[model samples]
Target: MKYSELHGNIDRGFNVFLLILVSSIVFLLLNIFFYKFQDNISYFE
Candidate 1:
């Protein structure tokens, strides 16, 4: 029983960490794209 509880906790922690990591990467990529587009607009002007 104790082992199962520990395993469950570990799985939950890993899943949470994975979700945060994916969200951060997506946000970072979006911000990078936004900046790139802004720079292009300014350059065109």
Candidate 2:
């Protein structure tokens, strides 16, 4: 029972880590795309 509890805790920690990693990556990608779009609009103007 103790071992299962430890495993569950580890799983939860791993999931949280993965969620943070994925969100940061997506945020970075969106920022890059937004900057590129802004530059294109400014260039056209």
Candidate 3:
């Protein structure tokens, strides 16, 4: 039972880590896209 509990905890931690990693990547992509969009707008002007 203790082993199972430990395994469960590890799984939860891994999932959280993956979530954070994915979110950060998405945030970076959004930031890059926003910057590019702004640059295009300025170019048009």
Candidate 4:
């Protein structure tokens, strides 16, 4: 019983870590895209 509980905790922690990693990656991609879009707009102006 104790082992299972510990395993469950670890699983939850891993899931949380994965979520944070994915969100950060997505945020980075969005920032890069926004900067590129702004550059294009300025180039046309």
Reference-based lDDT, each prediction: 1.00, 1.00, 1.00, 1.00
Task: Go through the candidates in order and give the C-alpha RMSD of each one to the true structure.
Answer: 0.7, 0.3, 0.3, 0.3
Candidate 3 structure quality by residue, lDDT tens digits, 1-45: 999999999999999999999999999999999999999999999
Candidate 4 on 1-45: residue-level lDDT in tens?
A: 999999999999999999999999999999999999999999999
The 10-residue segment of model 2 with minimum total lDDT is 1-10
RMSD to native, candidate 3:
0.3
Off by over 4 Å in 3: none
For residue 38, give model 2's deviation from the true position in Å: 0.4
Best TM-score goes to which candidate?
3
Q: How close is candidate 2 to the true structure, as a TM-score?
A: 0.98
TM per candidate comes to 0.91, 0.98, 0.98, 0.97
Q: Report the Cα lDDT for residue 14, model 1.
A: 100
Q: What is the clash count for each candidate, in the order shown?
A: 0, 0, 0, 0
The digit string of per-residue lDDT tens for model 2 on 1-45 reads 999999999999999999999999999999999999999999999
